[model samples]
Target: MSTTDVSTNDIVGAPVATTVEDVLSRFSGGNREDLIPILQAVQNSTGHLSRESVLAVARHLNLPPSKVYGVATFYNQFRFQPLGKYHIQVCRGTACHVKGSAAVLESLKRILKVEEGQTTKDKLFSLEVVACIGACGLAPVISINGEFHAGVAPDRVAGILNVYRRRAKNG
Candidate 1:
């Protein structure tokens, strides 16, 4: 996958590499209390925390690697793998469920060939099921990289993914 895509939220400096190191340099690098913020920063800067980044953060904080892993796993907010270029978040809240989001979710899984939280092998897409996205009125909504798709039906999943696929290829 091309990391240089214009749609990707890469850091402003056009960091070709050293994303973890670059994010790490922003912190104090020694305080125990700085762990969560450090992890958040890394995730924000790179879409998710990589294993190398987790280890790097542990080393920077002077903590055991297991400690960092434990803290990260304990929270639902942290993800160790980088997200795909197009991250799809399908809302499965009460309203969305009633509106057939389960079928929508299933269609997404089948079409993308990845379960929830898994990225496509090409790194073009990732699937996530969110509890609520504050679009209940537009129940059965899915967000692709924060752009909302409202009133989605299972049949529309392929068209939506095709649009992103075409965008990636054309870019």
Candidate 2:
């Protein structure tokens, strides 16, 4: 949502196997407004949008690659990089901030040994900060793979990380 442009490094490179032809075939080649659906389908197929997929879309939709990339970059929900198996989203909203969310963020960053928007070396977890999760009443919340942990303190972070680590180890 910032005016600053996201760098290509923000999007890890991975080849996309699913083509626009495949998407069009599935949709029966109706309207061009189907571009969004086409892109989403490619993303769902590849787990992330690879450079090849972008080019394929450009060719199929008769748009330039730059425009396609522009649209992809405009949306926050679309991920260019391959996400970790476990995605961790930490709330840093106003209410959370008032309740010491910074401490929780620091704890998570330390435990994961990765800065915000980076995935761990093991590819087990990716850390990200969200404005709010509407759990402000609980404040200082952390969501691991969509499961919310509220009222989290620095002390509790290690245990939570340990739980994920153990699960990873087992699997």
Candidate 3:
């Protein structure tokens, strides 16, 4: 089924019958081993693990909702909230911190009006502060949808965000 056939209410409240059915049909076994893969598949398609989807998975696997939630939460890969079109990852490693990444992060938070790990109200941006991104030489770095912006300064935050905003509007 197409994404258009699925409603936002269904995604957030209860799993759509068609969507859940379609996702379940992909797997063959009811063994516990199927749990991670099933969750991964659902998250892959839906972008995040919604409560409804988790419940549907629990029912399908004859497991408890708590178990599903426990596993999902244990893993860093799973996300409950819907991500914005632009996902921003700010480096907070030692090198980044020493190079003013904190200021850059503050700038992001101020300009986006969202705390770390939160999405903007407009669904245009999501902010995440990571411990490290393996770009020590490029300390004070921020990545927008995986495109690294090295040596980011607080003053440049608006201009950088504007580039993405313009892209969204133009596209």
Candidate 4:
């Protein structure tokens, strides 16, 4: 989205994204309690709800910026910035750990050439670590988006990443 679309009133000194007004318009005639939905709308527009977006939301709802920021930060899924298209999460639970999850993690870092929570320079992928995905049966599981990869070997990291690479290219 273009950055020119958002404007800030004198009350709040945050720069809203261009899509904030469209998001606000979705429930223009609704109740003020639609704060959560409003935030979600802003997040969808900008990938993450930025401080500016929250301020715009607060202004729209006639609520406090602190309150809007609090709610946005309280949710783990919400991000205050844009994220890459692909999200890769590796399982780090005991079962996976015993089965060489650390090696898997290391392999991923080497292959992707990025640290955990870091996105590839190309913006094609973002890597992260998860405690567990409850798929202990498949120890050392890795997830690309929501697709599960059980019984992952450090050797297979390249191939797995290649699958996403190919998919990204094809899509």
TM-score on alpha carbons, each prediction: 0.82, 0.69, 0.74, 0.60
lDDT of 1 at 84: 84
lDDT at residue 161 of model 1 (Cα atoms): 91
Which RMSD values do the candidates have, in order? 6.0, 7.4, 7.4, 9.4
lDDT of 1 by residue, 1-171 (tens): 222232233322122344878867767547888888777677767777778889999999999999999999887656665688888888899999999999999999998898886889998887877788788999889998778899999999999999999999999
Better model by TM-score: candidate 2 vs candidate 3: 3
Error of 3 at 44 (Å): 2.5
How high is the CA lDDT of each candidate model? 0.80, 0.74, 0.78, 0.74
Off by over 4 Å in 4: 1-81
* Candidate 4 lDDT, 2-117, residue by residue in tens: 32222221011122454888988876864567887777656656656767788888888888899888887786545564555677778899999999999999999998898775
Residue-wise lDDT of candidate 3 within 1-171, one digit each (tens)? Answer: 332333332222223334655777777576677887777667666666888999989988999999999999887556677678888888899999999999999899988898876789999987777778788999888888778999898999999999999999999
Off by over 4 Å in 2: 1-33
Clash pairs, model 2 backbone: none
- State which candidate has the highest TM-score: 1
Error of 1 at 169 (Å): 2.0
Better of 1 and 2 by lDDT: 1
Question: Candidate 2, which ten residues in sequence have the lowest lDDT sum?
Answer: 1-10
* Candidate 2 lDDT: 0.74
Ranking by TM-score: 1, 3, 2, 4
Write candidate 2's Cα lDDT for 27-64 as tens digits: 55545676676667766556567788888887777878
